[model samples]
Target: MSAARGGLVATLAAVLLVTGAGCGGPDEPGGGTITLPPLPSTERTTAAAPAAAVYRLSGNLCEKADQTPFADLYPREDAKRLVATEKLCMTRRTSAEKSVSLTIDADLLPTEAAAKLFVETGRRLAKRPFTDVDGAGADAYWDGDQDDVKLTSYHGNLVLEVRAAVNVKDGMPDDVVQRLVRVAEGTYAKLAP
Candidate 1:
């Protein structure tokens, strides 16, 4: 494996470890409060809505990839390779020539505060500086370097993220990144308030 890919994998692993560590035992002191860094925002979000009225996953998240819009954005080889869970939809492509993966996460939080905290924490954990993503969502940012791009957005009580990982020899394309962000944003909009 390339040094860059190895380093990226390690960095991502560290991020996951740190994020996972946020959880604590039921009796742990002050563990109920998720320890997240403050977001660089001054405005406050509105009060929480009823759980039934709030943003929640709808339909099959992975099925969106089968649509023409999504199919046209990705390589034909990756067209039908989506695997989705309650909170994530992922597509992977691997051939003798190249290998790449795209994953979209629909982060469902207990409250709007938790969602904002999650998004901000992800931005802080990026290996590279994050650039604000305009026209995507509220306080969106593109994290990670050129080889992989992690587009994150804050919408309602959801922190949507789309991560694209490509081989170092063939860096991720700008168009691909934009299209993936658009897809994620569209999906988020469709599923949330």
Candidate 2:
């Protein structure tokens, strides 16, 4: 072929290649610069579904009760309606040994009753001396002290109490206590009323 003709063909080929890349032509596998559906708004706008509120109460000793009233332990205004209640307790081999108990209450609607019960029970148990034992697991007790107790109420609504140091060999099984707590909490969450 003539030199002029060959040069013309080369120039045309280069132009075509540049045009194809710019336009994301068929030559490109998945087209060009694919833009994602405008990245989800990072702005802290309101959530589509609001998350449920969670509350934690700890280090509440009986001694502090004198300074802080039972009503203050769980403020009425913060209390949410009762969603459910869970009770857990541990038993000892003999009747003489002390038992420990724990309770957790959940609130669905949120109410003052839930908060009152939680604080009242906590104060009542803390004021009483609770014995501590070695092999009790989460809720163990000894003969010397009354027994260890823990109560947890959720959203200031549900109330759960754990009572330990009961007769284990003949009385309720340990597993039953856990099941009761779980069932009660779930039931309260459902809010039958």
Candidate 1 residue runs with Cα over 4 Å from true position: 1-53, 65-70, 73-82, 93-99
Over 1-193, each residue of candidate 2 has an lDDT whose tens digit, in order, gives 4555755766777666656557744443333433222323324223474444333333321211111111222222122322222222122222232322222323232554555555444433454433332221212221112232232333333343333233343343334434333433443344322
The local distance difference test score of model 2 is 0.33
Model 1, range 16-86, lDDT digits (tens) per residue? 66687677544543333443433322222234534432577765666543223334434445667567676
Candidate 1 structure, TM-score to reference: 0.60
lDDT of each: 0.65, 0.33
Where does candidate 1 have its weakest 10-residue lDDT segment?
A: 37-46
**In order, what is each prediction's RMSD in angstroms?**
14.7, 24.2
Clashes in model 1: which pairs? none
